[model samples]
Every structure is written in C-alpha cells, then in structure tokens.
Target: MPSVGIEGPVVSRGLDGDGAVEAPPFGNANEIGWYRGGARPGAAGVAVFVGHMDTRAKPAVFYRLGDVRPGEEVTVTRADGRTAVFTVERVETVAKDDFDAQRVYGQHKRGRAEIRLLTCGGAYEPEERSYTGNLVVSGYLTRTGTG
Candidate 1:
C-alpha cells in the first residue's frame, strides 16, 4: 500500500495499470508502488509517479491529473514529516520512447525541487496498442496549497 498520514491522505495501487493507484496527492510512485528504473524520494533524483487516465471499465486515479493547469498546487508528504509541495509548471505530451526520464527526473541546475507525473495519452488503442504516448506534468516545490 502507499504511505499516507493519519490525517493526511490515502493512496493504493491503481488497478488495471491505469495507475488508479493512489498515494498522497503528490507522493512518488516508488514510495507507494513497484516502478522500474527509479529511486526513492530524497534519493538525489526526481521521483516520478505514473498512472492511467482510464481503464477498460473506469477512469484511473490520475484521471483528473491532466485537468491540472500550470500554477496548480500538488502536495506530497514524505515519511520523514517534511511535506514536499510542488507547483505545476508545465504539462506536455511525448512519445513513449521519446519520454526522457533524465530530462524529466534528473536534478535541476537551479537547485530547485521538482516532481513529475506520468500517464498514457495521445489517443487510446482498444486492444492492440493501449496508449500512444505519455502525459507528463512537471512542477517545482512550494508550500502546500500555494500556487
């Protein structure tokens, strides 16, 4: 299960790979689920969380993620009691192979905190190819609820 505070929020593994898997509003998937090629929070790299916009039967947890506009606020509570909040800076669509993990998850030169959200996008395939690309939401850290 994903980590959450007693009074904060709860997130669980999303079903159908749609990543309905929920964590704290902005928690990294690694802290909550099994993700390949990523490190834990505060591990000297940008943590990434990924989910699906929709499943065959229903929309995933991050279904509404794409609805978040730039300047929106996303709050993630770390296990250490430090809440790493992020402000949505940009949202972009990229082909699967073209999705650059380093560019998206690597540390920034400006020494600012950052986070990334990923999901399948760019047209849904019914049975063969499920998704065409990834919808990435990028943000930098800030105080919670402040955009």
Candidate 2:
C-alpha cells in the first residue's frame, strides 16, 4: 500500500439517516472512514473517504491532507487483500456554502477509477463546532498490488 504517513486504519462507515456519510469520530483522530455506498477504491467510479482534520485536542489523521501535491500516491488496502494505488491529481479547499457537488462527487471520467479524500478546513467556527470549508484531495487509480 502507498504510504499515506497517517495513523490507524480505515473503517467502513455508512450513510446517516439524512443520506449523508458520516466522518470518523473526532475523538479517534487517527482513523479514516470510507463511504460504504460509493465505488470501491480501484473500481470504475469515484470512491470517497472522509476524515477529521483536527479535534479539540489535536490534529487528526488527515491533518495534512491539504498538503498532498499532484502526482503524490495514495494507497488503499481492501478487505480482499488487494491494494489500490492512486496518484493525486489535485487538491482544493472549497467553502461549505459553495461546494460543487457534481465536481466533488460526480463521475468525471467515464471509465477511470477515482478517489476523493475529504476533511474539514478553512476557519474554525467555535459556535458551530465546524469549519467553513472542506479540503478535498482528488486522485485516480494508477496501479494495484497484493497486500
């Protein structure tokens, strides 16, 4: 697996009652969550993973997610013991109010496999206990291996 330089393993997380995938708990700052309804990491569609940038006490697993540059590698190990290697295409921080759902979650390429790593970013709003924007790292499948 491509080393992401983070702590903890990714766990499967399903959508909430509102049909939205929940992020990993802030208390468990090292864990990442994969959206169960999305495509598999190396499948022919976009797969999504979400995490927390930071908690009240410290930085989380994806705290440096925004630092990922184009061409960097991200590796995900599936339950079947296969690893999907993805190359970062780009990274952006979008305001929550102006988030483009289509670009963030829609299928961009017809048959290529893609992945999006998401986390809270921008200014923290203490009153709302949230951030004003989201940090998204977009990547595409580049290779695979047995893990």
Candidate topping TM-score: 2
Candidate 2 lDDT by residue in tens digits, 1-147: 134565558989998786657887777778889998889889999999998888888888898887788999988888899999999888889899998878888776889999999999889899999999998889999999998
Best by lDDT: 2
Q: Candidate 2 at residue 80, lDDT?
A: 95
Clashing pairs in 1: 11-22, 13-21, 14-20, 14-21, 18-52, 20-61
With candidate 2 superimposed using the best TM-score fit, by how many Å does residue 72's alpha carbon deviate from the native? 0.3
Clashing pairs in 2: none
Cα-lDDT of candidate 2: 0.86
Reference-based TM-score, model 2: 0.92
Once superposed on the true structure, which residue ranges of model 1 sit more than 4 Å away at CA?
Answer: 1-44, 144-147
